[model samples]
Target: MPHIKNALIRYRIIDKALGNTYNPYPSKLDLRHACEMELYGDTNGKHISDSTIEKDLFAMRQEMDAPIKYSKAHKGYYYDNPDFTINEKPLSEDDLTSIQFALSTLSQFKETEMFQNFGFALNKIIDRVNVDSDARKSDADIDQMIQFEKSTAAKGNEFLQPLLSAIQHQYIAYFMYESFVTQVKKQRKVTPLLLKEYNNRWYLICFDSVKEKVITYALDRISDLEIIEQVGEKPSDFKADLFFRHSIGITASAEARPEKIIFSAGNIAAKYINSQPFHESQKIVLDTLEHTKFELFALISEELIRELLSYGGDIIVQEPNSLKDELVKRIKQMKTNYNI
Candidate 1:
């Protein structure tokens, strides 16, 4: 393998290629090719010399404080620090990885009708990245590198645009919605206020004109949406922070104040809770050898109850008899159901 000390590559050219996750190890030849591609955009441009690449690499280490490294196994150059920043804050190695991931995900939808709305903007962003990976690498190769819970046919994505437009224009929209509990379909007029995504599902937070209150409707439950000409004024009191202030998950009331919820967790559960908190207000209140106590200010909603119940024996509610009693009642129902 030809050493980087013997190669010559420009900052931006080498920056993108070195940082790219898809094209991890670029040999001296690869770095040279990258420099040629970036500088000329075609091979017909002036050929870059090996000494030029080597001198540039030396300057990057000494002048710019770049932690560039050579990987013998991959036979290419890379940055030791994933977060290393170049002059004027160019994309870091981590940033390049994220951008490549985003591009790969976007490519999946390139052939779909969904790109019709934001294709130009997406293309522009892609052009700006100008990162290189192996052209022969297939989507399956990336799929092996990283996996996401990508639901190809996740319902209600179709409603995102129209609902977004309604909110943007303050348009009074009408939709026939099916209630999950009642299974009753009814046409309702609402002023679309906000679009919220929770748990990989789309929901519309809107002012129900008939009910005269803010309501959340799952996009999957919505159909026959019609944007009306009659505009509605956005509620002055409807602040996003104040609206979801009390709630743990999607269930929130703007008028409600958050209550102090304290819970004691087992050793295993405490670590998990500490790392991935249920809410932004979560804090360590008390810690002991037996268990750790955590506190959060949130509404005692069904989502909170379900979260607590999911933990099973790993956690115990410390205060607020209201929540404890509800859990007890739920446990009793489960016991009766299972004949425990």
Candidate 2:
């Protein structure tokens, strides 16, 4: 398999050798022999060298920060603390409790095809923790202590794993996509670049071959997804950070450029804004007793407009007369809706 996989297998063999207290104290040669037997099997007389075992020990201690130390008295390598294992660090009681709750929450997705891989990963973690001495609580006691957040049922979630795999392996993805504007499903192929989540919805950022530009497609609107056998071309010029840097949400306007946006919030709302900023580019332009004036460098998109409108009269757009005018128009439309 892969080099990393081989390294992990070697580490496991080394760890098992050291942790075996019943066996005679293992020397460097003993460890190397153990690794080779596990790797190539007993019939193959070929074995790893002393240097390779030394590097594995050094990496485990220095790179992995494992508490490994050679014991002169024992005449072998072992964990500085006998209770420790190289596979995973010992979990705190609180950490174990949190993991139990997280496992419980994730278990809800165990039956879904999309979460099959996730379920396997979760089971490994559960097995690892269950083996730990600190995790001794009974199942009923764990159930009593933790409650998961209620999740709403969502469609198209089953496509998440396949799309994620496509993005990771740089595969061209074929799917039937239905846009909100057209309401007509169309078969399309795109180079999957990145997966993003916004407001509880997942979106795939991909290079659309037909359009010859990058586009964002909501997962909820995608169906009949498949990964093409051919490898996709990764755009050298595209940077995800720069692509979404100016825009507030996924809907980015190709023609729009970043502009200075100044807005003022009431004292109460200012505290909230200061604590949870709207954007990384947000700055406190002016703070006075009357109100707090903040400025942001961003493209004015529909999401930004909606966010500003959500604040109602608590926030005022002070600059870019265009943004203020749009807010006014939307407010008027709201007034008409209410027949005010």
RMSD of each: 17.6, 16.4
- Please, what are the lDDT tens digits per residue for candidate 1 over residues 8-46? 226766776676564577777777777776555644436
By TM-score, who's the top model here?
1
lDDT of 2: 0.77
Model 2 per-residue lDDT at 29: 78
Q: Indicate which candidate wins on lDDT.
A: 2
Every candidate's lDDT = 0.76, 0.77
Per-residue lDDT tens digits of candidate 2, residues 99-202? 56667778788869878856866776766556552326442444354443445645566566567778778889999999799899998889998787776688
Give me candidate 1's TM-score against the actual structure: 0.60
Error of 2 at 252 (Å): 3.2
Q: Tell me model 1's lDDT, rounded to 2 decimals.
A: 0.76
TM-score of each: 0.60, 0.57
